[model samples]
Target: MSIKALVAHGSTNGSTAQIAERIGEVLREHGLDTEVRPAAQVGDVAPYDVVVIGGAVYAGRWHRDARRFARRNADQLSRKAVWLFSSGPLDASAAQRSIPPVAGARRAMAHLDAVEHRTFGGCLREGAKGRIARSLITSGRGGDFRDFDSVTAWAERIATQSLGARAEPERGDLRT
Candidate 1:
C-alpha cells in the first residue's frame, strides 16, 4: 500500500500555509502521496497514513484552528506517524536555533504522540490581514523571515525517516 501524508496548517496571514505547502511538496518529491490543506478545511484524518500539522503562533499561543483539528482528530492522529510545526517568529531566531513548540502545540504534541515538532521563521508583508500584523509591518518589524531551506531540510528528514521505516515489512508478513 502506498503511504499517504497530509500537511494541515492553521495560518492567519498565509505565511504558515506556504510553509505547509512546501512541506507537502518535499514529501511528494520523496514519493509519498501528499496533500496540503488548511486545518479548518480538513474534515477527517482517517485517509492519511501520516500527518503533519502546523500553525502560526500569536502571542505565544498556537492558532485556534490547529488546536481544534488536533483535538477533533486526536484518536486517529495518535495511531499514525505524526509531526507538528509552528511558524511565528518574525525574526531569524527560529533558523538560528531550535524554537520549542508553544503551549498549545506542546499539549497537542503530547496528546497526539507526535514524532517531532519544528518551529520556522514567520513572514509578514504589506496587505497582510489583522491589526497586529499591520502594526508590525508599519513598525518595521515585519518581513518574510521564513527560511525555506530549513523547511526543506526538515521535510527531507521526515521523508528519509518515514521511507526507511515503512520499507521494513511487519513481523507477521510472510513472503514466498
Candidate 2:
C-alpha cells in the first residue's frame, strides 16, 4: 500500500510554502506519495494517512488559517499520524533553542497522541512587507537560517516510522 502525505502550509511572504515544498520533495524521494497544498486548499484531512501541517510564525504564533485547520480537523486528525512544523526564527542563533508555539496553542497540540511538532528557521524577504511587519522582522534580526540537512533528516525519520508501522507482517516478525 502506498502511504500518502498531505503537506499543507500557510505563509505571508511565502517562506512557509517553500519549507512545505521541501518537505514534500523529501517525502517523495523516500517512496511515499506526497501532495503539497496550501492550508486553505486542504478541505479534508480524513483522506490522508499522514498529514504534515506547517505555517509561518509571526509574533510567536502560527498563522490563523493553520490554527483553524487543526482545530476543525482535530477529531479526525487525532486518530491518524500527524506532523506539525512552523517556519520562523530567521537567524541561526534563534534556531538553536526550542521556540514554543503561541502560548495556549502548544498545549492544545499536546493533546494529540499521534502528532509530532518541529520548529524550523525561515527566511525574510527584503522589501516584501509594510512598515510594521518589516520593522518587527528587522527587530528580530532576520535572515535565512534553514538547515537543509536537518530538515531532510527529520523527514526521513518520519517516513521511516510511519511506513514501518504500515509494513506487512512477516512470519516470526518480532514486531508482530
Candidate 3:
C-alpha cells in the first residue's frame, strides 16, 4: 500500500503555503501519495499515514490557524507519524544554523510527539497584506528570503524516513 501524506500549512502572505506545496511535491516524487492544504481547511487527520504541519511565525508565535489545528487534532496526530515546520526568519539564519521552534511549536511538538521539526526563512514581498509587511517592503526589508533548497532537502529526508518505515513488515505479518 502506498503511504498517504498530508502537508498542511498556515500562511499569511502565501510564502509558507508555497513551501508546503514544495514539500508535497517532493514526497510525491518519492512515491508517497501527498496532498497540500491549508490547516484551516483540514477537518480530520485520520486519512493520512503521515502528516506534515507548517506555520508562519509572527512575533515568535505560530500562526493562529496552525495552533488551532494542532489543538483540535491533537489526539489523532499523536498516533500518526507527524512532522512540523516553521517559516519566519527574514534573514539567512535558518540556512546557516538550525533555528529552534518557537514556544508554541515546542508545545505542540511535545503534545503530539512529532518526529521532527524544521525552521526555514520567511518571505515578505511588495503588496503583502499587513501594514508592517508594507512598511518593511518600503524600507527594503522585505524580499523573498525563503530557502527552497533547504525545503527540498528536508522533504527528501522525510520521504526516505517514511519509506523506510513502511518497508518494515508488521509483527503480525512476520509469521515464521
Candidate 4:
C-alpha cells in the first residue's frame, strides 16, 4: 500500500506551518499521499502510515497543543513511523546551532522510536520586536533562515524510505 503521511504542525507566527507545508509538498512530489494540517485540526492518525509532527518553540518550550498531541497519541504514534521537527531559531547562526526539544516534548518522545528530529531556522521581520530584542535576533540579516533545499532533501529521503510499498503485490514481487 502507498504510504499515507500527515504533516501536522502548531505555529504561532506561521513560520512552522510554512515548513510543514514545504515538507508535505516534497513528499507529494515523491509520490506519497501527504496531507498538511494544523495540529488542532487533526483528529485520528490511525489512517496514516507515517506521521510528521512539528511545532514552533517559544520561551524554551514547544507550543502547548503540539506537546499535547504528542503525548495524547503516543501509543498510536509509537506504532507508526514518526518524524519530528521544530522551527524557532531566527538567524542563520541560530539555525545551525544544536537546539534540542524542550522538556515536556522530550518526555513525550521518550518512546517514539522516531526516524529523526530536526530543527529548522525560523523567519522573523527585522523590526518586529523592540530595540534590544530586535538587535539580538535581527542584527545582520533577518528575512528567512529556513533552508528549503535541506527540507526538500529530507522529504525525499523519507519518501524513498517509506513510499516503496505496493498497493497490491505482483505475483512475484520481492518487495512484497
Candidate 5:
C-alpha cells in the first residue's frame, strides 16, 4: 500500500504554509500520497500513515493551532512515523540558525517518539506582520530567510524514512 502522509502547519503571513506545501509536494514527488492542510483544519490522523507537522515560531511559541494538533493527536502520532519541523530563525549560520522547537511542541512530541525535528530558516516580509513584527523588520532584524534547497533536502530525508528505504537514525535535528 502506498504511504499517505499529512503535512499540517500553522503559519501566519503564509510563509510556513508555503513551506508545508513544498514539503507535501516533495513527498508526493517521492511517491507518497500527501495532504497539506492548516493545522486547525485537521482534527484526525486515522487516514494517514505518517505525519509531518510544522509551525511558525513567534515570541518563542508555536502557533496555538499546531500545538493543539500535536496535543490532540499525540496518541495516534505515537504509533505513526512522524516528522516535526519549525520554520523560524533568520540567521544562515548553522550554529546560529539552529533553534530548538518550541516548548509546547517539544512537550507534545515527547510521547510520540517522532522520527525527527527540523528547524528551517523563515521568511519575514514587509507589511506582512503586525506592529511588533514590522518594527523588528524595520530595525533590520528580519527579511526573507527561508532556504528552499535545505527545505527540499530535509523533505527528501523524510521521504527516505517514510518510504522504508532506510532505517532512520535515532531522532536527530535538521538545522537548515
Candidate 6:
C-alpha cells in the first residue's frame, strides 16, 4: 500500500498555509502522497498513516482553532505516527531562537510520543482586520521570517523515516 501523509495547518495571514504547502511539496518529492488541508477542514486523523499538524503562533500561543483540533484528536493522534510544528517568531533571529510552547500546550503534549515537533519562523502582513491582529503586527513583533529550506528538510526527514518504517516487513524470512 502507498504511504499517506496529511499536512494540516492554521494560519492568520496565510504564512502558515504557505509553509504547509512547502512541506507537502517536499513530502511529495520524497514519494509520499500528501494532503495539505486547513486545521478546521480535517475531519479525521485516523485515516492517515502519517499526520503533520502545524499552526501559526501569536503572542506566544498557537491559534485557538489549531489547539482545539489537537486536543480533540489527541487520542487518535497518540496512536498514530504524529508530528507537530509551529510557525512563529518573525525574522531570522527568531528563526534561530527557540521559543517554548505555552504552558498549557506543553503539558498537553507531554504524553504524546510525537515523532518530531518543531518551531519555525513565520510572516506577518501589514494590515490587520481587528484589534488583536493589528496589535501583534504593529507591536514591532511581526514580519516574514520563515526558513523554507529548513521546513522542506524537516519534511523530507519525516517522509524518509515514516516510509522506511512501513517498508520493513513484520516477520523475518525462513529459507528452506
Backbone clashes under 3 angstroms, per model: 0, 0, 0, 0, 0, 0
Q: Which ranges in model 3 have alpha carbons more than 4 Å from their true place?
A: 171-176
* Candidate 3 structure lDDT: 0.90
lDDT accuracy of residue 113 in candidate 2:
50
**Can you tell me which runs of candidate 6 are displaced by over 4 Å?**
171-176
**Tens digits of per-residue lDDT for model 2, 15-129:** 8888888889988998889999988878887777888888888777787767877777788777778788887786774358776665435743665453567888878866646
Residue-wise C-alpha lDDT for candidate 1, range 35-116, written one tens digit per residue: 9999999998898877999999988999999999999999888888889999999999998999889999999999998999
Q: Write down the TM-score of every candidate.
A: 0.95, 0.86, 0.95, 0.80, 0.88, 0.86
Off by over 4 Å in 1: 171-176
Q: Cα miss at 163, model 5 (Å)?
A: 1.0
Residue pairs of candidate 5 with colliding backbone atoms: none
Q: TM-score of predicted model 1?
A: 0.95
| Candidate 2 Cα misplacement greater than 4 A, ranges | 137-140, 168-176
Supply the TM-score for candidate 2: 0.86
lDDT tens digits by residue: candidate 5, 18-102: 9999999999999998999999999789888779999988888887878888888888888777888887776674235556777
Better of 1 and 2 by TM-score: 1
Q: What local lDDT does model 1 show for residue 67?
A: 98
All models: lDDT? 0.90, 0.75, 0.90, 0.76, 0.81, 0.77
**Cα RMSD to the true fold for all candidates:** 3.4, 3.7, 3.2, 4.6, 4.5, 4.6
Ranking by TM-score: 1, 3, 5, 6, 2, 4
Overlapping backbone residue pairs in candidate 2 total: 0
Model 2 accuracy (lDDT, Cα): 0.75
Q: List the residue pairs that clash in candidate 3.
A: none
Over 49-123, each residue of candidate 6 has an lDDT whose tens digit, in order, gives: 787878787777887767877887888777777777888776676466766665434643664567667888878
